[model samples]
Target: MKRGIFIVLEGPDRSGKSTQAALLKTWFEALGREVIVTREPGGTYLSEKIRKILLDPKSRIEPMTELFLYETSRIKHTLEKILPALKAGKVIISDRFTLSTTAYQGYGRGLPIKTVETLNRIATLGLKPHLTLVMDIPDKVFARRERAGEKLQGADRIEREPDSFRRRVNRAYKTLARRPGITRVNAGRPVAEIQREIRARVAKILKRQAWKRGNKKQ
Candidate 1:
């Protein structure tokens, strides 16, 4: 069977990655594709446990400690959930992936980018997403959304971080956008507009993959 498409939607908190993931899943299902929507650090039972520790505001985790936790969760998520889904030919729409770790732990926490990349390779076993949509939003928009109480009540540890940290993360995402297999989406528009743009890009990728497969069969 053909390996499934792996798409990751990554961005800062409240950037609508989850919303886009859901929309993408629905769109894929409508096309009669088997779709699985999962998130990093919480895809499997062990990963979910690690997610709680990583996201608890009361917990005090050192930078390197936090990094290892994320990678540990990732390996489990990759081995238990992602690889199997791909082998079975099911589309996977993940809310966040390795990019998040690079942005959050590497840039936001002031870790070495090269070290983070190496760890990411080890954790994911060198599996890369087919497409990664970096949902880009301006700092002002992000602050406004936070001030507007978008998710103030249930803010995760990362969300409760200082503005400086969030700014670093935002910049990291912008820098990461230049990498291969990444498409930066301007997420400051209306929800429907953003989804439309996402769908268009995804359609192109699907078409390209289909062409490649047809040629291989020929």
Candidate 2:
């Protein structure tokens, strides 16, 4: 059987990654495809445990330490969950993946890009998303969202970073968006508008994948 499609939604905190992941899951379900929706750094049991430490505001995790924690979580999440689902031919809609590390650690934390990329490769075992949707939002919007009440109760360690850190992460995202296999979606617009755009782009990729599979079946 053909492996499943992997779609990763990436963005900084409060950037609508969760909302989009949900919408994408719904869209894939409506199409009658088997789908497994998961999130990075917390997909598996051990990964969730790692996530707690990584996100706890009181935790004083060094940048390198944070990087290793993320990698370990990815290794577990990918091996136990993501890989098996793909092997079963189930579509995977993930909230974040290795790209997150690249943007957050490499760019946001100012770690060496080469080192970050190397670690990501090790964690993922060279697996990559077929398509990545980057939700791009401005700092002004982020500031407003951060100020809004009720987002903090569940806020984690990463969200507690300063505005300067957020800007750096956003910059990393912008740079990565220009690379291959990545699409940038303006998230400052209406949520519906953003979802519509995402659906349209994803549709194209699905169609292309379908064509490839059809050829293989011939």
Candidate 3:
């Protein structure tokens, strides 16, 4: 049986990633595909504990230390939750993945990108998302969302940072989207419209992959 596709949705905090991920999960399930919806930094029990430390507002963590903690959680999550589901031929949709680490810590926190890449490789065991959906939005919108109380209670550490810091993170996301195999979505659009666009894009990719698999079998 063909292994399942790994789809990751990445963006700055409050960019509607969770909503889009849920929409995609439902869309895939509606098509009769087995889908496993999970989130990084907290997918598994051990990872969830790590997540608390990583996101806690009061935690005084250095940039490098924060990076390793995030990677640690990812390693646990990948081994315990993501890999097994993918091996069983179930589509895995993640709210955030390695790209978040590259953007948030590498660019936002000014950590070395090379180090971040190495850690990500080890954490994910070289697994990569078949498609990465990057939700792009302006800093103004993100700040407004945070002020409006849409931010996650504990995960607002990044959001509460200075505006310039958030801009750097957003820029990193845009840059990553320009890389091969990453799709950029205008997250400033209405949530419904964004979901529709994501669903269409995902459907197209799945169909193409299915055709490729069929041809290989022939």
TM-score of each: 0.94, 0.93, 0.92
Candidate with maximal lDDT: 1
Worst 10 residues of 1 by lDDT: 143-152
Error of 2 at 85 (Å): 0.8
lDDT agreement with native, every candidate: 0.90, 0.87, 0.87
lDDT of 1 by residue, 1-218 (tens): 65589999999877888888888899999998999999997899999999999999999999999999999999999999999999999999888999999999999999998999999999999999988999998888876664232445677888889889989999999999888778999999998999999999989888998889999999
In candidate 1, position 166 carries an lDDT of 89
Better model by TM-score: candidate 1 vs candidate 2? 1
Task: Give Cα distance to truth, residue 198, candidate 2, Å.
Answer: 1.3
Candidate 3: segments with Cα more than 4 A from true spot:
146-155
Model 3 residue 48 distance off true place after TM-score fit, in angstroms: 0.5
lDDT of 2 by residue, 1-218 (tens): 64588889998777888887788888888988888889888899999999999988899999999999999999999999988898898999898999999999999998999999999999889999888888898877876765223445866788778878888999889899888878988999987899999889888878898899899889
Model 1 stretches astray by more than 4 angstroms: 1-3, 146-154
Name the runs in model 2 displaced over 4 angstroms: 1-3, 146-151
How does residue 215 of candidate 3 score in lDDT? 93
Number of backbone-clashing residue pairs for each candidate, in the order shown: 0, 1, 0
